[model samples]
Target: MKKVKRRAMSVLAIILCLMIGVSVFTYRFFSQGSQWVNFTANKHIYSNGVLIGGAIYDRDGNPLVHTVDGVRKYSDNESVRCATMHIVGDKKSNIATSLQKVYADELMGYNTINGTYSVSGTGNSVYTTLDADICAAAYEQLKGKKGTICIYNYKTGEVICLVSTPTYDPENPPVISADDDNYDGVYINRALSSRFTPGSVYKLVTAAAAIDNIDDIFEQTFTCHKTEVINGQKIICSGTHYEENFEKSLNNSCNIAFGNISRQLGWNTTAEYAQKLGITTAHELSGIPVVKGSIATSGGDNELSWTGIGQNTDLVNPFAMMRVVGIIANHGMCVEPYLVEKVTNSSGFRTQLPPNKTEKRYLSQSTADTLSDMMRSNVRNKYGESNYPAGMEFCAKTGTAELDGSQVSHSWFVGFSRNEKYPYAFVSFVQNGGSGAKVAGVAVTRVMTAVKEKVDSQSTAN
Candidate 1:
């Protein structure tokens, strides 16, 4: 009986030992397999390359956004912030944050401890046609004085340079407050958000609209003076423009003459033109957030007149206006504007992104040509003798928009470069500046001169 009991106890001990061994083996096998799977997954992700930040480069491989001198020299992993602190924006907020959602898969490989990933070396680098030195020189010349400066590649809609002051740094942008007092700080993207009366700039639109719709627009001569009564309200021209035809009317910035043309075009046509050019409510800007801007909907004869004259509830960004000018320069086709060239990964592997599609034709090629000619003539006749380049041929338009009930007004200038063989388009605006031609033109000239010099240097170098 004693032997039987001991044998039974031994058998029970053996069974318990077998159970513990099986459990240990099972645990080891699954744990090892899980670790292996995780390793394989991560390896695949990094195999393609380490993800990093995006960049903008000129045709010559010159960095435009600029880099900090001492930080991570080559590897995007440790480089300091670049100049585009305001332009390219940050990954946390503003335009870059929203862009991240769209580029999630690409940005996934470079997750950092801070929960933010570097987007620099994920794919192709953005290649801009803008000359960096030219952009720098232009910005330097127009640093002070409230104004906007924008340069665009007419063919590709690639914005070479777009600066609006007082400019804010995107890296450390002022916190936008809910209070109205914070409006100034919120003016970070004045080139795209701030609404203003276009003043004389609308004359270009009026001229085009009237010519397209009215047969006798060019034939009619209208006298413009202190004021003209429209719907019993007094609408005034800047100066005593006197009696002039359409061509002279534009050159003089005749408000009365343009107001009449606006009445003829009607509010609907004016709105249509605005929509075609992606202005007011129809325009879409990635930085401005994926939404359309506000355009006044109260349509009236007087409102139409105001709209035609670039006033009465009409507001647009400088970028949008520049695009309108680009359409004419590009023979009516308005291409989509893009700042990024291509994104690359950390391993230096490149991926070509599909080009942004060119959309919408606002005006016919013929209209574009005529408008271009008219703008050129107006510039030559007014500032030509003093400001005109001897060998450069260009078309330009200036605007002095007013702020109702206030002496302060917004000044604007838009034009295209017709250099020897290169074509570039730009827009400039000065907030609360008295004269568009003087305040805005001075800045525009500096930029254009720098651009020309850069082009010349590049040509010589090549």
Candidate 2:
């Protein structure tokens, strides 16, 4: 009787073990095969391996913006022009996904054996130093206008908010068949994809180059009376101004003074300074297909003169401008800007992104400090007392770029917040808009205020 009881118990234990083994096998087989495809393979392809340059979230892990799927409708008939047009890019997900399909396996993990294939996503998450509240605020303020707003972390080289007007939905993106390259057919990611004349904003580069190359730039004053002749070509300023110092040249966006300074530095020096600021070939390192802007060195003295004041085919994108400001904020170090904060695996293992290769000493510490001070002065002294923020030490540079025949100018503002923390930095542009101070300044302030409000609220809670 005892032997029979022991045998029965052993049989029950064997049955249970077999059942467990079968369950394990089934799970693995399904998970590694069809189940994986069902779970991972995109039900709707947005863009092949293009990935639309992954959307970014703030440090607090809130999503500020994303691509729109073609499935929905986006409307813009408000005070703000259309922030989505630039930052959110276009509704090319379907075409992007289709084009990426060929490269998908190469970029993403796949399960393949015995004539079967399954694809899994890249499984990476982008962490940006941008505060979400700030991005939304900027977008909210610039909704009806053709504009752009960019924010970054100067210390980390992380972009906070990149808002461009005239946005589109990424998920239900608009359909684009073959041979569609016109700007109207697609949404341009103006922040990185579209290039514009830097206008007054280009002066930042001119200032840095002049200070770096020319001796006694502070003491030198360039005489200006509305227009000046360079290489026998007439160039005019927005206003008829007299002799001015470097500080005033920047504050008033004086073309004649900047043009003279550029003439002194020459084209070679201007190009070199731009390259150092990560404006030239540095786009490749940003992990996006950047539209290269031209600083026409071949245009001789006249071209150089115009380029100095951000005219005559000197092109740049909003995000790139933000990076240039970031270098100034970081006191000369310019890091390769990135969006992905971290990556995680299916097993719940977290991995930090590869460290950004930071190129140090793009500008001398003194040069950066000087530039920052000048930017601050421009904001405080020139923008008028009413526009200035009461409490913050906002260092900024405003730009107004003239496009050949266009009546309105593209407005731009790039700046860093707070004297104490230097916590965040950003750039904003309003397309075919007014002056940088009147339009871009208000947008930047709104975004900064929103970001501060959110941060302060969180601090109070903690």
Clashes of each: 21, 43
Question: In angstroms, how far off is 357's CA in candidate 2?
Answer: 5.6
Error of 1 at 432 (Å): 1.4
Tens digit per residue, CA lDDT, model 2, 1-462: 999999999999999999999999878875665334433334432344234322333467554332344232223322222333333223333222121222232223233452122123223234445445555567787766666787766776666666655544443444555674333423555666677778888899889999888998999887789988878998889987797888988887889999889989988898888787867764742345655667878677778889888889788877778888888877877765655454333333443446466666788989998999998888778876456555557888888778777578888888886454446778888877778778887888877777666667787899
* CA lDDT of each prediction against the hidden true structure: 0.63, 0.65
lDDT of 1 at 352: 46
